[model samples]
Target: FEALHAAVAGLPVSGSRVLPGLVLRRDFAAYCPASGELAAVVVTESLHPALSAPGVEFVVGSEGQYQASLRWCTRRTEAVMKRLQSSNVKLLLSSVKQQEVVIYYAKLYGVSVVECLSSEEIALICEITGVSPCTPFGDNGEITETAVATFCQPLLLGSKRYVHVGFTSVCAFQPHCLILCGPVDGVNEQHAAALQGAFTMLQQLFKTVDQ
Candidate 1:
């Protein structure tokens, strides 16, 4: 990570704004899609397992399941939501249900939620916005001031328009780079091909150097 930081810093920039380091927080967790069970309970400085026991499982069609789910969700979400609600920066999730109960709570808290993003997209958004993506229901290390100057506007090429969004935070998995390109005209393949070629070349160069 330090070497990558040095390399990025060594790159020449045409403007006066120092290129922010592609530095991710040391506390970021590893990606584990199947680890949902591991996060069923969120322990924080203020919230801990000692405060409550796991709820008893009830049979289907009974209110037990709903009550348990809601209790778990609220306890888990509240831990992080309270911290984020007071923050001035925007929040982006890789994917979230518009009708999810969490969304309703998030709205109530005045949190701005951008959903349906992929992990890569979230990382890209972080790079452009300089906001770290925090783990849901987990500790948010330190909320830094938003990098207002780092915002990027949508790129329009002919008929296709591309938007960049990110999820950057102290708990992001790692720093990443992403470039999204699509045809403005539904039939235009040339632009997409060119962009893909450039991306591939860049990847190959990086891999070669790493080797």
Candidate 2:
């Protein structure tokens, strides 16, 4: 459990931490297998088709330009997925939403996807996993680095849904998550505050022990 410094982004990621172990509450995983596990995960921004942008400014009589651009974007996504497949990467994570075409190609390549992540979450992930937040995105985009995980699956905590993941890192701390179950937001917030105070006390206790 190294790097649990002051900036230890508690992140309520129901999110990312740079420590060896991380607590991630993923939005959702697509095309996840029955085992709910992925060998490696790559986090990136968006996977939208570049050709489909509204700002492309079509010609006065341009008939099939839009359709052609869409096709091109889709094809590029396919190529990117192919590269991932060849690299044995089984999971893709996106900080932003993914387009349908990107999802389709991912699934076709036998890769799973977790999308709609916040920037902080993405930063934590990159920090902990030692993976850069770069992937095949733009016309010149072409990085597909990955972080290995022991397990990746959906977790049901009360009525809310979360994703539980086991990351492999150099740190000795195995990250753990604590979920406060309360009917209302106010109660949960109170619980969070109490927990934070408790953790602070524990940290002090640990320092005393170290001394």
Candidate 3:
């Protein structure tokens, strides 16, 4: 599915294999669609874009240390969210659900949160944005300084909702999306394999011709 999706996008953008578009396949999970600017793609270790601070460990009689850890995290998380907000980052995309404390601060800072993104989707976003996947910030191995998305929204297709966006920094051509849907998993898998193979062939052919 990814190979085909990228190939299709390559066609419109002068034919380089780096995908000029992004695709979101439905996983049959019930999720609401949303719209926001994907201005930055940050690779995070934790839900928040901040690093864990050095704090005292909690012992049987020392719950204060645990409380301090929570407080430290919340303060750092809020600071990070504020930076994102000031930078006009309206969307927060995470691979998993974050702690409510993270959510509350993001909301307070006026950033929309979208969780449950798969690794592929996140990688695709990074590629489209030309963001380095291994970008590091401070002592933490997280990236917080990449931006590219121009427009973003969620679209309802079939029985699922998919996020859609138009890129501002895409390849020379316009972005594209190829959504493949099937009633059953087997059917979709077969179709995805076939489609991917076909596009792979075309990609090889294009590369040969370009060379």
Candidate 4:
């Protein structure tokens, strides 16, 4: 709590800024049956904080490759997939071992499947980015395609655990949102300034608080 408070208070008044970004992937989608709409109750308790940041954005679409011939594409699906593959989509699709087949297929279409991070890594990403990290409190293994049904457990009539972090809720974590800091082209000056400022503020805050 003290650290969080300090980081915010010590934010740089002025300096070059570096935009920090985070990509969160979960295998929950693969846990559902191959066909039809399946439901799962992934606990968002951890992700609530990070997804709540200002400027944080969410894009939902196909996560894998686009092998379907252009002729087969419906305008709606095509439009949605385009958004999912946009340069702004930093967080990678998260899935478990069972979904490797689907993931492989997704890769064939140009999707970049990032291996699921462990709980600790997840925590680190959230802490460093000032986003709230959500961890599954239940014990489970990397899911496979066949066993994906296990992830679709129904929520009780009055329960809310099955809910996903709403789209609007996830996009709010902007200022602290992890900016994509990778070898990409066309990054603007404002992004660089944001990143630099975030780091500089953090450093100065640490020094002052240590005393």
Using lDDT, give the best candidate's number: 2
TM-score of each model, in listed order: 0.41, 0.74, 0.69, 0.24
Provide the lowest-lDDT 10-residue window in model 3: 6-15
lDDT of 2 by residue, 132-197 (tens): 876566456555467887777665554456555667764554555554445555655666677688
**All models: lDDT?**
0.38, 0.63, 0.56, 0.31
* Model 3 lDDT per residue over 147-190, tens place: 56666555555545555555565445455765555555565566
Q: Clashes per prediction?
A: 10, 2, 0, 45
Q: Tens digit of lDDT per residue, candidate 1, span 137-157?
A: 335444443433223223332
Judging by TM-score against the true structure, name the best candidate.
2
Name the lDDT value of residue 157 in candidate 4. Answer: 16
Stronger candidate by TM-score (2 vs 4): 2
**lDDT comparison, 1 vs 2, better candidate:** 2
Candidate 1 RMSD computed on C-alpha atoms after optimal superposition onto the true structure: 12.8
lDDT of 4 by residue, 139-187 (tens): 4321111101111222211211121211111235432223222222234
Candidates 1 and 2 compared: the better one by TM-score is: 2
